[model samples]
Target chain A: MRVGELSRRSGVPIPTIKYYLREGLLAPGVATAANQADYTEEHVRRLKLIRALIDVGRVSVAGAREVIDALSADGRDPLDLLGEAQYAIAPRHRPGRESPEWPAARERVVALVEARGWLVHPDSDVIDLVADALSAGDRLGVAEFFHNLEGYADAAVQVAAMEVRSVLARPDPAAQMELVVLGTVLGEALFSALRMLAHQHESARQLGFSPPTPADHGVNPAP
Target chain B: MRVGELSRRSGVPIPTIKYYLREGLLAPGVATAANQADYTEEHVRRLKLIRALIDVGRVSVAGAREVIDALSADGRDPLDLLGEAQYAIAPRHRPGRESPEWPAARERVVALVEARGWLVHPDSDVIDLVADALSAGDRLGVAEFFHNLEGYADAAVQVAAMEVRSVLARPDPAAQMELVVLGTVLGEALFSALRMLAHQHESARQLGFSPPTPADHGVNPAP
Candidate 1:
């Protein structure tokens, strides 16, 4: 297939596909003629992953490139693989003006992870990411959210263990790395959406809202 | 307190505060004289919430205003409150080009929710959100992610129940609304960061990497 076929197959516009090519998000196709390149099925697949990262994960093109790069990188040291995967999951935070609440919030994060016996490096940018979110909650006058930290951590640890097991089960090393990106980026989107629905469900259950039935979704029960 | 004092206390600059005020994200302070206005403690807290939504949650100014409006709206019917809170969590998705996989994925979502016995409306945008994410995973050629949907939904249900309980425990109706915003936006951020750290910890444990010691974080473990 050429660019048009790739675009049609992938449902990405030609110009945007060209843009992704220019941004190195999609690997170059083999040159066939003047101003023409032959794309394979892989190009179509990569385009979808790029859109998933940009549209769903809100990751920058640069971040997407990093993830794509890590996806192909196999047989690396586990620590190095973890380093790149973490970077892809949460892009490094830019330096910003520090709030007065930052230190205490950061300490709370460090303390929580320590209490959980997590073996992540202290220098992982995720520490600051958690701290930043904690302080943002504090600043919003919703410090009550902080009380739920242990619960969140417990759930995360359980979910992460399951995720790691799933990824490790992939037979191929490249497939393993690909699952890392999927489980990190799309996984969050899926989780966030489900969490929203779950919240609505819980609120309804607790507040006496009637349960939605098969009729609500066009499913008819037998008479 | 005047606008200047409001800026000082809130740590938001006067210009940005004026921008937020003009955007209707912050309510207008009491006009005491020409070219001056007296703000209140409520203004300071609102400023923090506004920044949290914009800076941390990446909500647009208009969306922040909607959330702020919902925060002050009390004693509404539970369904109405849930409607408004759901909007606060997810700014409505704009219509976009649909992929071929959309219908099947949407059906899968409906089936999952129905199986869970949730009481949410069929028209909730979150259904489309989950569908979009699922199809994005399909497009990315990671259909293996679909297998984990049940697990993700499981965690979401448990976590959402805990969150709703926490929100309901708030004595004030308005406080309950505030917790909804905090739990939705900041809660996702907190979860994402923790999930990343957990992934790293799990990867290291499963891959036989050595754990970081107290010295790694400058805490000396007492022998």
Candidate 2:
């Protein structure tokens, strides 16, 4: 296949495909002539993955490049590869002047990790994320949100365990790595949507509204 | 207090605070004179909330305005206010041309909601979110990811229930609405970070690596 067919089949514009190629996000096609190149089914597959990462997964182009590089790199441990994907997708945080609340937040995070007996890198972006949320909660006077932490952690661990099991079951390392990356990225979106739906259900119930039956169209009034 | 003191107290720069003021993300300060405005402690509080929503919660300027407006709207039902906040923060999706897989994905979501006896609106953003994720998983050939859906839903419902209980416990409608907005936004970040940490711990355990103790520094040896 040529770039034109690749673009048509992948639903990506030719210019975008060319940009991806130039950005090292897509592997270079075989140079068939001075102005043309022949792509393979693998290229089609790679293009789709790139679209999924950037479009659906909402990863930045640079992040997608790192992820693709990590995916293509052979002989790396699966766990390390997973770490690289996590690092790549993790939101970048600007360093801020140390605040009065950070120490307490850090201590709380450390205590939570220790209490759970979960081993994670001390420098993991998650550490900063957890601390940031805690600090923000404290400042906003919503510290009660942390009261739900234990429950959230329990659910988080269960989902994480299931994900690790699924990833480990894959025989091919490349396939396993791809799953780790996509699963981590898209999985967040999935969980978020589900959580919102669950909130709607729970809020309705708490407010004494009955569940809406299928018969209820546009306006789902409480029965 | 005045705008300058409010800026100093909130750690938000004066110009940015002015921008937020201009954007209607923050309420106007009481006009004491033609050129000067007097801001109250309430102004300080509102400024912090705006910062948390925009900076930490990552809500857009327009979205933040909707949220603040929702909070300030008197005599609105708490549940309705929460719905507004959720809508403000919901990821906007562009409608796509109908595809073959969408029917199946939509069916799966509908069935999941029915089975769970959830009363969510049929046209809820969350429905699209779930369907999109399902379609993306199918295209990515990771359909097995749905095998974890039940577990994920269980966890999601638990967290959602906790959030609702906390919101309902708040006596003030405005405060309750503020929490709903901040909780939905910041809570997502908190959960994602926790999930990553949990994944790290689970992956380490599955790979036969021992848990890291606090004393163990830099080099976490792979066993």
Candidate 3:
């Protein structure tokens, strides 16, 4: 298939596909003539994955490249590959400050980790994220948000355990790495969305408001 | 007592403070004289909140203005104000495509809600989010990711219930509104970081790798 068919099938524009080819995000198709190349099913699959990462996962082109490289790298530990993908997509945290509240917030995070008895690297990216959020919560005078950390952690660990278990069930290392990346990135989006819905439901119940149903949207039932 | 003092105290630059002032995100300090205005403790507090929203919550200036307005609005129901904040911060989902997978994904979300006995509106922003994620997961060929939706939903509802209970405990409507906005935005970041840590711990245990401890980073122990 030519780039035109690939673009049509993948819902990506030909120029974007050519750009991806230029950027080495997509492999070159076999040259059938001087000005034409033939793409295969593998190219189609790769293009879809690239589109998914950029569009749905919101990963940068460089990040997507790193992810694709990790997926294709051979002889690397699956765990390390997963780490690379996770680190690539993880949100960058601002550097820590020397403010008094900063230290207190760091202490709170350490306390929560100890109480939870979870083994995580002290300098892990998550440590910074947790500390930053706690510090911001303190500054905002939202003590109650921090109070719910334990409940949130409890729920977090449950989902995390499930994710690890499911990903490990895959016997193929490459498949495992792909699942880890996709699950970690897209899964966050999914969980955040679900959390929002849950909030809506709980708030509606508390406020005595009936939530809109599918019927309200005219979503027809299956006949 | 002045804008300069407010800047010094809040660690936000004067120009940025002025920008916020221009944007109506921060209320003006009382005018003491021509070209001189006296800022109060309220100004300092509001400045800190604005910084936190911009830095940690990643709320845009416009979004922050909406949030602040929601907070200061008079005689509005606290829940309604919270709804505004949540809506403002809710992650925008891409419009659904007219494809078989899209409708099937929507049906999956609807079924999940019914099975869980959740009271969320079918037309809620979260519905599109869940459906879109499911469709993406399906397209990415990761069936196991969707398999864990039930667990994610269970955990989400627990956290959401705790959030509602905590916010409702605040008697002041403005404070309640503030908590809702802060929690809805920053809380997602916090939970996501925690989830990453949890994943690391669970994966390390499964893979028989020892995770780095606080001692590895020379983090001082509490005396």
lDDT of residue B36 for candidate 1: 92
Find the candidate with the highest DockQ and give its number. Answer: 2
In model 2, what are the clashing residue pairs, if there are any? none
Q: Write the per-residue lDDT of candidate 2 for residues A27-74, one digit (tens) a residue.
A: 899999999999998887788778877777667899899989989989
Write model 1 residue lDDT over B1-223, tens digit each, in one string.
Answer: 9887898888899999988878878889888999898889888877877777777777778888888887776677655676676676574553232767788888899889888788777877788888877877776777776677888888888888888888888997776877787678888888888888888788777776655576574322234
RMSD of each: 4.1, 2.3, 5.1
Worst 10 residues of 1 chain B by lDDT: B214-223
TM-scores of all predicted structures: 0.90, 0.93, 0.86
Complex DockQ per candidate: 0.56, 0.63, 0.49
C-alpha lDDT (0 to 100) for residue B101 of candidate 2: 72
Model 2, position B63: C-alpha lDDT score? 80
Model 3's CAPRI class is medium
* Candidates by lDDT, descending order: 2, 1, 3
Q: After superposing candidate 3 on the true structure, give the runs of residues whose Cα lies further than 4 Å from its correct spot.
A: A93-98, A114-119, A207-223, B93-99, B208-223
Off by over 4 Å in 2: A94-97, A213-223, B93-97, B213-223
Report the C-alpha lDDT of model 3 over A1-223, residue by residue, as the tens digit.
Answer: 9889998778789999999999999999999999899999888778877877777777789989988888888999654665677777766546335566887887777777776656665666667677777777776788667786789889989999999998999987866877888888778878888888888778767766654464563222223
lDDT of 2 by residue, B41-154 (tens): 888878877877777765678887887888888998666776777787876553231656777887888888888888777777678777887777777678787776888889
